[model samples]
Target: MPHRPNTPCRHPGCANLVPYGQQYCETHKLLHPEALRSAGSRGYGSRWQRESKAYLRAHPLCAECARQGKYTKATVVDHIKPHRGDPALFWDRANWQPLCKPCHDKKTWNEDKNPVYSY
Candidate 1:
């Protein structure tokens, strides 16, 4: 079997090369334990894959982009409310919305970094 070429570490400004199938080299990898987690553990197993695909097919346009009058195609099915390991919330289709990659990333960053709580 042919061997795959090593790829650069995904960490920004890091030119270090890592073996194929690995996202970050050893040093940077420690900084992102969440990325190192398995997809199944992150609630992105076969079920989520299937459901998210169907959702994207049904809601092809990004919700955030639509608000801004841009018709971008949604590639991610994001939960409007953070599931936070709650099985019920994770599987709730009503809490889901279609978002493009940029919108999803921005939303995730904001929520993860600066969460708002209703108390």
Candidate 2:
């Protein structure tokens, strides 16, 4: 049997060669098991992914950045109001807004830490 051509592991700083079909090497994959989870298991499904893509396509700019007069591109579709696991609000288009990853993460972190926090 002949050795297959080696491809670099996708993880940054990793030098390990992975089989063609795999993304991350075994070490990284084991360290980040969530990467192996399905989209639905990660709080998103095909429907949400589709909706998010459409919203981003239409919006293009991050809402928060726009509010500050900056025009950064949005990469996340955020819920204006937390759905709190409610299917109705969770799927509500009116509650959705496109946000850059940084803005979204900061907003989400603040909201998670305090419901009525400011500044």
Candidate 3:
């Protein structure tokens, strides 16, 4: 098979080509680190849990699953974009979507270093 054409990485000053299906090359991704933290960190505190749970309660079906004609029950509320501990993005209702555990895990798999739930 012929090789797929590569695209330039979006990060400034970087000439690396991003692999297919990825936004940034692995090196650039590491350079622009995510604001990751353990569960008990300030950004992942109790208030977030309550708010996320309320979001899920208000929208109790997986958005992705619904697109595929499956009315799966949502167990999690996800950020449409990676918040990376940004309060503005994390709390934005417009950025939130209801997702079943499986859908949530799949959506976040590439964004984060580890899966929220194992398959």
lDDT of each: 0.89, 0.82, 0.76
Q: Which scores greater on lDDT, model 1 or model 2? A: 1
By TM-score, who's the top model here? 1
Poorest 10 consecutive residues by lDDT, candidate 2 = 110-119
**Estimated TM-score for each candidate:** 0.66, 0.62, 0.62
RMSD of 1: 6.0
Q: Which digits, one per residue and each the tens of the lDDT, describe model 2 over residues 47-114?
A: 88888899899999999999999999999999999865568998888999999999999999877545
Q: Which stretches of candidate 3 lie over 4 Å from their true place?
A: 1-36, 113-119
Per-prediction RMSD in angstroms?
6.0, 8.7, 10.0
After superposing candidate 2 on the true structure, give the runs of residues whose Cα lies further than 4 Å from its correct spot.
Answer: 1-43, 115-119
| Candidate 2 clashing pairs, residues 3+ apart or interchain | none
Q: Write down the worst ten-residue block by lDDT for model 3.
A: 110-119
Total backbone collisions, model 1: 0
Model with the higher lDDT, candidate 1 or 3: 1
